[model samples]
Target: MSQQDPSAAPHDDRPRGDPWHAFGYVVSGVAFYGFLGWLLDRWLGTDYIVAIGIIFGAGLGIYLTFSRFNRALPPDSSHDQHEQN
Candidate 1:
């Protein structure tokens, strides 16, 4: 008699997605930094800095993604700490 669709996800309490967010962070970071690096290279007439910028961007993006998604578990209550087995 269950009305729920069996083919759908079983849990309705699932949290929001992170894959797209992570992808966006990385792609945007690389693109934005790449552009800046390209501009800087043109201005300074350098050849290797663009690679550095891309690398930096990717690293920053990964850091951001992790920082955004990581969750700390809630601390146990004092009542629980004193509970008997």
Candidate 2:
């Protein structure tokens, strides 16, 4: 059996999450807000149009960003990459 060197540093093997999920979430949120705001404007007869859309879209974007950040997993420090035995 090969022994590990005491002076050598430990390795990390962790799966990094993809960033496209965030982009997709932001895009979807924006589209949803836009559609909802338009419907609200038509129903409420508000002179100020698209303001709600901008606000909600921005808010949803921020929410998505935070959600993605929180959901992302931290890097693994263990050198164990499992394979089917």
- What ranges in model 2 sit over 4 Å off? 1-17, 47-49, 71-85
Query: Best candidate, lDDT-wise?
Result: 1
Q: What is the lDDT of residue 63 in candidate 2?
A: 88
Give per-residue CA lDDT, model 2, range 1-85, as digits (tens). Answer: 9998975665433324567766776777778887788788889887455577867887888786776566654554443343322
- Residues 31-74, candidate 1: write the lDDT tens digits: 99988999999999998878888998999999988877775545
* Model 2's TM-score against the true structure: 0.52
lDDT of 2 at 82: 31
What's the lDDT for residue 37 in model 1? Answer: 92
What are the RMSD figures for all models against the true structure?
6.6, 8.2
Worst 10 residues of 2 by lDDT: 76-85
Q: Clashing pairs in model 2?
A: none
